[model samples]
Target: MTYRKKLIEVALPLDTINKESAREKSIRHGHPSTLHLWWARRPLAACRAVLFASLVDDPSNDLPEEEAKVERDRLFGILEDLVKWENSNDENVLGRAQAEIMRSTGNNPPPVLDPFCGGGSIPLEAQRLGLEAHGSDLNPVAVLITKALIEIPPKFAGKPPVNPESRGKIGNEGNWRGARGLAEDVRYYGKWMRDEAEKRIGHLYPKGPNGETVIAWLWARTVRCPNPACSAAMPLVSSFWLSKKTAKKAWVEPVVDREKKEVRFTVMTGEGAPRDGTVNRQGATCLVCDTTVPFSHVRAEGRAKHMEQKLMAVVAEDERGRKYITPTEQHVVFANKAKPSWRPEAELYGKAAVNVPLYGLTTFADLFTNRQLVALDTFSDLVSEARKEVYKDA
Candidate 1:
């Protein structure tokens, strides 16, 4: 089945300050080292205003060290304010619960899904609101964290952090085990290589970038054949193709001169052409075997000129020639299989005509269910409408 086109109006939240206010705040808080702190605090309108005013109101004769200390204090105050808000009712419990509920219901609420399985903050909130919630996470730790937060037993509702020493020991043990296993694997692979064709193929064994061994012992075992006859026992040759000079003589085009105008021609020749009598108008002998070409062949017209040139240039050069001209250039062409044809109707209508129906907008209310969906839809619509109004004013 063809998928339905979905158009979504995604609205991002607005910044707390206008450009003019932001500029003023920047000037008020503009210390060389405190720019980062200034920008970070700008998201919190109250904290930003306080910090900005403090920087502007400071009456000390601006010394570099004094200014730095002031900036540091301002940043610390901002951070403290942020921490308080982050742990407050609006950001901590309520916000988390709302998010959890939305995630469980998929922004559409129940009869769509249970609102209070206590899987996340949302589920716990759902339970508090007299609904059932459900959720899942791939990470076991995340699952535990969520469960602990939502299913807090009466005695363990608030607890201190885990002991640092205990956590450190566990982490250290895991790291040690991993390192030991890696070392064992390396030792095993090294021993295996020594036992197997070490004398013959030791030089060919690969090494890591830092000149240290990298391939594990188990990996080397897989590459080795248990059946001796099927093993790669042969020595690895450097190259199989002809040397550069020989290849050039065999494949490249020869130069030709016609009516004082010289043009190079690419011509394929048989092995027999070297022994046959052929020569160009110039007295130059064949570049391959040094054989003299017959004048009749060189003077011959059309296709014969190419054959005669190939005979003289490539096939007839001397095997022991002290000086040789080799073709210095090469070019490569890449080709792939032809693409399948597009539908004629689709091609005629153009992209815009097809895209309109494909990307048509959709409402969350129509697509989802329950109070969670309702809340999310309302929030999204409010944000979108606000953005539209802002853009219209701009």
Candidate 2:
């Protein structure tokens, strides 16, 4: 007897598979892709079809043309049902596909292994079809994600959560299926952690001028003007436009106090267009003195830690929409209050690929402000506490 071809060797329902795969990206709840940011993640639709077809055999050539046509149509029907995103977890659909896999393999299909599984798509789909699935990767993050998607779920699949809050809420024990309890525990503990973080650092984020909650503060990096006669801190910004939407035109206007030799920025809204930004390819123009400052001077100032950040705008949200505020001394004082104790002093990656190092941002920690660093440190400590809580619940 000659070896026959597998169903995967033949054509697939590409249009149906592609359309469903595109729709899957918008599915946020309980999806493994949301576990982490893995580039070029293999879509579930493609993986499911691939696994099913690889196991089942196509019709042999020796059969009559009509017989071969019927067999091909039967296999195509299985594929059409298999690639639908909505039917991924449907027991009846999965059962039909799994039965076909068993029949083709003589009830002894080989275990699936994905040695370089970046996002656990292949192994997860294999396990979904009731097969033994194993996954590995060079990246520890990928390995952790794979374990969460395939390994850890089986151990906690049908169990009720041990956490007190979730345990109180869950009614039927039999209804607890496929990590639902685990998801509830996560939400409950996650809210608790957020509350704790707010208690610790709530004072850092003050409301905007009208008492609307201040969502974000915009700032521009500055370096002292090279001209001694007009030593103003010049802002290096590419554009002044805040919002270019139809009637909501807004931009920044730099007000130069010539006596004090300072450049203060104000938010401008409505029809009138704002002036071009200071920095360009060659150099920056001093807002106060109109003197040309070279890029070399700015680079030197950055290297010497003399570069400063000036708040340009304050973004706050109200009942209607977002409102931008002109910077005030009080708001400036709130920004100055942060003094972080920890920073990532590790060197950055290769200089050839990265451009920030040329302007003194040579470390990973340099990318964040002191306030942001403090928040990150607080969250890092809270993650450890959350893990301990998980251990207690388990």
Which is the leading candidate under lDDT?
2
lDDT of each: 0.31, 0.83
Query: What 10-residue stretch in candidate 1 is worst by lDDT?
Result: 217-226
lDDT string, candidate 2, 279-376, tens digits: 88888888888887788888888888888899998888999888778888888887778777789888888653277776888888898888888889
Best by TM-score: 2
Report the lDDT tens digits of candidate 1 across residue range 216-255.
2110000111123332211111121121354342332334
lDDT score, candidate 1: 0.31
